[model samples]
Target: MIRIATPDDVPVIHTLIRELAEYEKALEEARATPEQLHEALFGENPAAYAHIAQDDATGEPVGFSVWFLNFSTWRGVHGIYLEDLYVRPSARGGGHGRALLTELARICVDRGYQRLEWSVLNWNRPAIGFYESLGARPQDEWTVYRLTDEALESLGKRG
Candidate 1:
């Protein structure tokens, strides 16, 4: 079962995020606190939205997706930028991942969005394979870039 996330789901969402970071071998960078997440998701002006996938029988959350909108100039429409989608290690392969993605796709289609996108670490073969199986193509022509920390501060000062 899938449903929109409520404020009560923040703790579990944070846990899933930490678990995902661990899986990606970057746990140290997963520094978001539950309060920060709550404010992000439930603040007066929400920056993102989330969905929870519940265990069918027990109704316990087993997976989740957090996403925000991104505008596409070429497509002339807004698309969902999935920040994270994760199923608990013990609960993987139970269709939770696919179910979460299907829901997002449906939202895109219903809202007339042109695309649904997310980035994957290069070494995550299992996730890449799973996404490919759902007909998701890689945008290999474009390389992702980031400016953060001291570099970001320097640029801010230069400007």
Candidate 2:
């Protein structure tokens, strides 16, 4: 079963996020605290939303997805930017990942959104194959960039 996450699920969600980071060999960069997650997901003006996937029989959460809406100026419509989608190592291969993605697609279709997108590490061949099997194509022509930490601070001060 899958359902929208509530404030109470923030801790579990954080745990799952850390687990994902570990799997990606970037656990050192996982700095999201539970409080931060709660505010980001449940604050008055939420910055993101999350969904939890549970075992139907056990009723225990086995995976989670964190996402937010992004505007496509060219398309003139909103799209979902999936920040993280993680299924517990033990619970993987149970269709939880696909189920979560299917739900996101359903949300996009229901809201008349332009697209649903996310990034996957190039080294994660298994994940890449899974996404490809789902008919998701990589945007090879576009390069992604980021500004954070000292660079972000420098830019803010320069402005």
Candidate 3:
């Protein structure tokens, strides 16, 4: 079963985040605290929303997907930007990931979202294939950009 995550699930979500980071060989970058998650998901102004999938019989969480709303200037409609999707290795192949994606897609369709977007690591071939199997195409024309804390600080001092 998949449902919106609650405050009590923060710890499990954090654990899964770490596990996913480890799988992606980026564990060093996974340093989210429960407080951070709490504020991001449930604070007065939320930054994102999370959905967790649980075992129907055991009630143990098996996977989760986090997303946030984005506005597309071209489409002039709100869309969903999937930030993360993680399924425990042991719990994979149980259709958890597919189910989660289907649920998110349903939300987009129901709400008239013009697009749903996410980025996959170039080396993650399995994920790329899986997304392709779902009829998702890579947007080759665009490149993603980010500014880290040090970069932001430097920009502030550049004046």
Candidate 4:
């Protein structure tokens, strides 16, 4: 069963975030705190939303997806930018990941959004195959860039 996440699920969500980070070999870099999650998801203003997938019989959450809306200037419409989608290591092949993505697609269709997109690590072959099987194509022509920490702060100071 897939359902929207609530504030009460912050702790579990944080755990999942850590688990995902560990799997991606970035556990030491995972800095999401429960307080930050609570404020981001349930405070006066929300920056993102999440959906949780639970085992129907055990009622235990098996996976989750965090996402937010982003604008595509060329498309001139908003699209769903999935930030993280993770299934517990023990829960692979249970369809939780697919179900979470399917529901997100449904939301896009229902809301008339132009697209649903996310990034995967270049080394994750299994994930790349999974996404390809789902008819997702990589944007080879486009390069992704980011500025963080000192660079991000310095840029802000420049303005």
In terms of lDDT, the best-performing candidate is 1
TM-score for all predictions? 0.98, 0.97, 0.96, 0.96
**Winner on lDDT (1 vs 4):** 1
lDDT of 4 by residue, 33-108 (tens): 9999998888899999999999988999989999999988988888999999999978878999899999999998
Better of 1 and 4 by TM-score: 1
Candidate 3 residue lDDT tens string, 60-153 = 9999999999999999999999999988878878888888999999999999997989999999898898899999999999999998789989
Off by over 4 Å in 4: none
The residue ranges of model 3 lying beyond 4 angstroms of the native Cα positions read: none
Point out where model 2 deviates above 4 Å: none
> Candidate 4: what lDDT?
0.93
Full ranking by TM-score: 1, 2, 4, 3
lDDT of 1 by residue, 1-159 (tens): 889999999999999999999989999999999999999999999999999999998999999999999999999999999999999877889999999999999999999998999999999999999999999999999999999889999999994
lDDT of 2 by residue, 87-106 (tens): 99888899999999999999
Each candidate's root-mean-square deviation in Å? 0.8, 0.8, 1.0, 0.9
Ranked by lDDT from best down, the candidates are 1, 2, 4, 3
